[model samples]
Target: MHAITPYLLKSYKGRDTEKKESEHFDLSNIKGKDLLELLHKYMQSKSAHVYDFKEEKRVFKFSDIDFDIKRRTVSAFLVAGFYGVRSDIIDKSTGEIRFPKSESDAEVLRHYIQFTVPPGSTETIGLFHKSRGVGIKSLFDKLFKANFLLETQATLQITPYAHTGAVQEWAKGASVKSLKVKGFVPSSDITVNLARLGECNTEFTISPKIKKKGFKASFGPLSDFLTPEASSTQNEIITLLSNQGASVRTVAELNGARRTFEVGANSGGVVCDIPFAEGEDEVELKGGQPEFQSTQKWARSLTNDILKGVYGRRAFQI
Candidate 1:
């Protein structure tokens, strides 16, 4: 008759914080026991899944015999297989597989347990991971284009030029007190003129010596501007441009101004402005007029109203 032997298998060591909560179990240790019966007794003794068994050669095998801690769930692989078992088997003649006898050996089992458990439960594991990945990707894409813009002049020039006289004024010695855009919308062609505190040569170049003020301009789609994608692209372009030292403000400001201009124009506010050339004698200007003078005048007036803070105050006011 084969004698069944029962032995108390040590419990796995928990991590530092969990060490106090770990439990131990004991059973009868016997020799020449049937492997399956030994496993049943071990599993029943501790209410856990550790088991030891011997094969035809009397080689000992250690197994978890329960849920896979690594996979975060109970699975057949951890129950009936050799997951935590050693590769070497003991022979009755060789005495190869031996029971662990030291604290270090018990620690090995503890590590196996700690390494198997997942950080979080199976549910909601991938929640923020997806959003975080998208945000990082978008940020990098924007940053790459911004770096590309710094190296190319043509790319900078491709942006619609406002033709503000400040470019020329900055070339001259005159200090520009204020810069305003006239007849500009998200899609409108902007025209800017610089004025000095006093009369000067109209053909004179702006001197680099003058310290120019920072520029601030807002733009949005005209009433007739129909493309939504273009509007979004323009907003992104403007943001990138501002970061590159173009001195732009919030995109919200541009959208608000556009809405105000549209409503005001519909209510009979003029939408243009026209400027008479500087230093033009009355006789030289008496009969000369551009065919688009009226339209230009309307645009100038609307832009001036926007710059003077009238449009913004009215559009966004409570």
Candidate 2:
């Protein structure tokens, strides 16, 4: 058998204190993949999921297996997913299937559990170590200053991104702050006409940045902005623009503050309705990402999609 990869392990305190410093353990003996595969095998057995595991003097326990990894002696959980996910995704025989077929199993495994490298109680990876977004302001403050903006200076040929319900299912495991895709319902003017601009599958890149505060009650996190696929950002942007006029670059800029507020009122972000706009009109400004979501789905990468140019939405770098 191939040697398994090592891991950086740590304990997860409760939710209220989640943001605090944590304690870590270096699992010097077991490889991460080996540990996870063992957990998967055990989870398959209803009774075996919860059990004790020991490494030298350190003791660990997976108490009621609904994603909870605890020290055999304490009640703490482990910091898993994302940073420690390679072990879960890659298997010697199965390749890179990150999630299980059963929704129930996948959810439990992804959420509360962790095949992870836990950080020490005193560790810090610097202050900005977090999912990028205008947090408190997104919910309470009316103003969301642009963190960084990427407007298309020229015509951006969009690529058709595809996803089955399964890939989306996996996203929930790794999804950061965004709500799932099912949370959204497409707006009437939010058309997906691949052939909007003469011929199919193309969009004009007009300047898409506004100076002032953009929205009123924006919902979902930055991750929610990426819908079923990438480019979901520009897709929604064009859909709104098509309602006003159908050009790529010229009218793309919402020059006056008056018109900017209107865009928010009239349209939705990559997926969800901008909810409502306090201002008059707006456009995608840069800086920290401001994501969009209608009902569900979360691929915040910068795609041609809309709203947040993040999650899995891919933006062309010019």
Count residue pairs with overlapping backbones in model 2.
65
Q: Tens digits of per-residue lDDT for model 1 on 34-89? A: 22233333334433543432221111222333433333222111111223334543
Off by over 4 Å in 2: 1-21, 26-34, 47-318
Let me know the TM-score candidate 2 reaches against the reference structure: 0.16
Cα lDDT tens digits for candidate 2, 1-318: 000011122222224456665432222112222223333344344243333222121112223333323321111122111121222435646576765443112112111122321222211110010122111111101110111012111111111122212123222322221111211223344344533533323333233234457642222222232232334653465345545442211111111111111122222232121211112122121232211221011111111122112224232211
Candidate 2 lDDT score relative to the true structure: 0.23
- Residue 259, candidate 1: how far off, in angstroms? 22
In model 1, where is the ten-residue run with the lowest total lDDT?
Answer: 123-132
